[model samples]
Target: MSQVRVQPTADAIRAGARAIRRRNVEIVNAAGLGHIGGDLSAADILATLYLGVLNVDPDQPDDPERDRYIQSKGHASGVLYTTLAAAGFIPDSLLDTYMADGSPLNGHPDRNKVPGVETNTGPLGHGLPVAVGTAIAAKLDASPRRTYVLCGDGELQEGSNWEAIMAAGHRGLDNLVAIIDRNGLQQGARTEATNALDPLDAKFAAFGWAVRTVDGHDIDELLATFRAAPFERGRPSCVIAHTRKGRGVSFIEDRVEWHHKVPSAEQTAQAIEELSE
Candidate 1:
């Protein structure tokens, strides 16, 4: 069967992202914990994938032929959970159980517990390797299924990711795509302060991957980029998505401390207000 690309309208994509952001704030406020900075920064990317790009069935999430998505920057589980609910993978009510005792929703994603999750991932640099293997398997079977991994820019400093980059490039795994959430800030400081990832596009290019840098929050650009994955016929694809931490909330925007900070009631209300517009 020929692939029919998914292309949701830009307005629809923006609405989806708004809902994800609103719900992410709600979940964090309820649980009194979350990585809101990264969650907000990557919310649009997550929304784009779940609402349009991914070939996933909410009712049949485990289908072998489904395209795969691994959230490499797993600290932002709130956005992942909110996106999953928005995509109908889980009941929206399940979001209430997040960070609660015995709840399947942990601070990091657990595929064994989440129906739509492709693999358990939290540690930085792990998802790409797993994605590489999955993409290799798809190639071996001659399946057209694709695999995507979203990693934080700071996470790129981990050595394991380069290893996967090398392997994917060397193997010509064109079925895979890696997106970096380039929000600039990490947990304790700016990514540049801790470890610079400048020249990131060139580095990926050096590894033999086709690279593109895009406005991560732009729904239209995100949809276009995802659809154009495997930019080169025999090479993997990499998208460096420049984003801002705490994107929808004016006060917290680009603030490093918001990485795991729970929003206060007033702050939550303000954030929801901005997102509503």
Candidate 2:
């Protein structure tokens, strides 16, 4: 496999975004099922992080000094797997096996089977604690590694995340960054309707994290936010990325039905067409 050059140009990020969006549509279309809305919502953030910000090597996935990324909203495994493939952590051909009877790439992420995945995460609110542990380990070893965890806004309702958030701040883990994919919608309905987590920025601030809000789909803003480290001394960072579930495809955007709906052949074709352009 050939490696793409390591350069953080705007064009590269946009290309990665397009590739991930295209790959997500292909995987779901081929498997006949997936969390398409969540996958689409988090595509750009994953692309920017993996291609530009993350200090990972496809050739040496388990390198100790490498940065770590944990996907707490693991239902969007399609997005992560495709991003891994694009980053050369997995072969592009393996993507053909997604969601097959016995494929390693299941509907949710499994760290044991995947090379670059830092932890197995499917249950909401799990990755934050794991990420905190990883950061703590880095601090203990005096390692200069950074840890990032991307989670859904609805997942915030899980008490485990709050616990982890408190610990991250209490420990003064400035090497850690938690990104929330605040698409406003969850599995069934809007997060506001299911369990309101508004005033999310203030909540994080009160918890002791330096918080920032940005349009998640904007490549420039995403890159800038990731580059700007810990908003304050002796505090971890939190970026609340306001995103639209099913961002690229018009039919699926902001529609709760697309949360976990499998696109039919026609819908798939339309999605591919829209994303390609």
Candidate 3:
């Protein structure tokens, strides 16, 4: 099958991003709970991947040679689900069932039920290894498909990601790209107050990754970064997306308390209004 040419215009990309954030907010508001902070933080990156970069078809989600997208920071499943729905990977109505009993859309992403989700990830640091394995398989099969994993900055505290990093570099898996959502804040508090990953870019470089740091909310920057593939001939690439938790909403941005806080009805309305502006 020929790869679908992704000539995502800036307006379309922005629309996708808005749709993701709006849907995420709606889901969390309906469920009366969710990791909205992280969800909002990663919305732009998710939009860039699903709508701008990935060669995936919502109609043929199981195509073997299609690019893979894994959400390593699964707690933000709200964002992933909304992104999938916005990108047509799943019915938009299913978002209403989020966190409901027996619904496939749970608090954490499940690969079994979600068509576009590449792996079941709720535990931190699991996505990189899965992505690395997928990248290796693509290489072995001589397929041009690439693997992209979105990992949270706090999730990097887990040692497994480092191991995966080493393996990807050692095997020269240039098909793999890891995008870190560096929103600074974690569940309990700021990442710096807990475990600092200040030298994150250098760490990836030391592990032999070609690193690119960009503002996660900028559509132009994200599009450019995603398109500039294979920064190094024999090395996997890592994009440190510096983002703010609760990015689009002013009151919530960078607020650690919003990590798992469900916005009140009034706050939700305000947030939606703010995003629409």
Candidate 4:
């Protein structure tokens, strides 16, 4: 039997994002490792997609007709795991075992082990290509299912993404939507300081994509943008969402060093306290 999926209100989804963030901090702190910065950066995006946009039935995870979502920014597994648990794709008990010995929850997501994950993706440039292929397959099957991928801005420097972008546009895979977490910071430094992706929208547009930029933290805007897919016919849509790394935490926000830093017990308490507010 398929689970009922009543879409949450935008405000409710926003609260869900906050809960996801708090859970993420707890699990990451307990596990002593996580890409927390990126996890925080993309929380709102993940929550908005799972709770209010995607047509997924957690109880029927392998529903062939369900929409496909690829966490292209896979290192941010903390956020994804929390979102999956919150969305009921996985049990909340599973979170306590994150990264434990023999735990199904690895540092990076594994499709074979995790429910709601469409494919295995951890290599920086791989997810978009897979999502493009998924979108193309849906088109060929005449399926209404759509494919959405979340890529980090830093990963866009990979040549393979452009190749996939070129292919998606050329094929006019209007069912495909690629959302870039434009947080500006990567693991080591600001994206511009490492390898700039400024003019990113123009770059995608040049490849025949219809592009729109939105504040990634804005739940209402995110819901509206994602549901209004295929912003133009005959073009894959790209939503470049501007976000702050380590969002919602005053000390860590936008600081590059926090990319994969494990928070101390005190910091974790503070982060949880702030997120609960």
Candidate 5:
């Protein structure tokens, strides 16, 4: 059965976001490879979900009735791993082994190796389709579980996501909630410079989704938006979380080059200090 969604205080959510950012820096510094930009941008969203929105038990991650969360922007797996550790799914010590040889914590999350991870995802545009399938299954089983997927705005250029979007809206999978990390910047440059997803809200609305836009980093807004999923009676829900790339770190914030760039010792120190504040 679906657990009740916890409405967290702003202070609590901000604290969680800080912890995730601090740990994310540490993880990337230790691993020497990560999608740091996206990781930072998506940290708050991940924090809000694991800390308050998702109905998941670390000890019972595979429970059939538990709410499902899929990270569509899997390149930013560091954020996901850090959030899982924060939520007690695994020891914080495991974070030290991230991206190391023989470590289960690879660049992309592996469901078989990581507790609380719903699936293995790294390629763009894959998570939403899988989430749609799972949502459909839950509906067929008459389960109370809700499916949540987090995708990057740049990844929306993929055809697969649109196909899944069409299918989800057509099938009226109200149990599904898709959150887009609309950080604007992709790996190379602004998403609009590469492949424009302008009128993103209208695009999804036309697909028969109940669309809503929110400050992705705002904990209070995230909690409220997620708590009110399936915004319409018979259509799927889509949340366009407007976020800044490399959020919370002054040097990296909104810089496209920082996408997978590793921070130097000085940069890492500064990032830690800023997030700690």
Candidate 6:
């Protein structure tokens, strides 16, 4: 413990999430590079996990029994770094070096440098497979600790994820929970036009996962849905969190161009103000 501890309720998680968004805008504005849209969309989910749900303790990051979290949508690292800072895994000051030449805060997370990250993740479709392995290890050890992975809707196009999905389902990795930040837009266009994943829930169900759909931005709903995991016994869980890219900021919300765009000084201020409320 650096300072942060798991918050007791959904309201506390929501408040921390707002702070995360405010700091995330600043982090991107200062660093001059970031996947702002996806970062904003996943802020609530990350915050809820780091601050309210995951069994990770900042001081005991490598505790064998601690829950594992992998950011499969690794491009949105600004939010991940900010959430880690808020969770006390890293000092808030370390965030100032994000994306800098010698910084550990790279464009994507590296477990070697980051205390809470379970593994290196940047390439799409790789994390869930790694998470499936971790969950399998836990099963072998008979540990109660869970494995969670957050993925991007766009990356679902990769065949590797499907393979991992099939393996987890077939092995009955009920300890695994995969959350897709289903914000619709991906990079320059919408996921539907690019590679439709609309029947995502049915796909997961068919893959043998207990599926649940929730408003990704609704903190209370997300918290409740996550807590009620593995909707069925002996099955993996898939949470399709429908969200808008650039969720909290009015001008940036759902704008595809903002996917990797840096906010101007004025826009950053406006975003911070909006998040403050």
Clashing pairs in 4: none
**lDDT by residue for model 3 over 110-141, one digit each (tens)?**
87998988889999999889999999999999
lDDT of 4 by residue, 21-137 (tens): 999999999999999999999999999999999988888889888999999888998899999999999999999999999998998899999999888888899999999999999
lDDT of 1 at 235: 95
State the C-alpha lDDT per candidate.
Answer: 0.91, 0.92, 0.91, 0.94, 0.94, 0.91
Per-residue lDDT tens digits for candidate 6, residues 15-83, read: 899999999999899999999999999999998878777888888998898899999988889999999
Off by over 4 Å in 1: 1-7
Candidate number with greatest lDDT: 4
lDDT of 2 by residue, 173-205 (tens): 999999999999998899999999989999998
What TM-score would candidate 4 get against the native?
Answer: 0.98
1-277 in candidate 5: lDDT tens per residue? 3445456687898898899999999989988999999999999999999898888888778888899999999999999999999998999999999999999999999999999999999999999999999999999999989999999999999999999999999999999999999999998889999999989999999999999999999998998999998799889999999999999999999999999899988899999999987
Best by TM-score: 4
lDDT of 6: 0.91
Instruction: After the best TM-score superposition of candidate 1, give how far the Cα of residue 94 lies from its true spot, in angstroms.
Output: 0.6
As for candidate 5, its clashing pairs are: none
lDDT of 6 at 2: 36
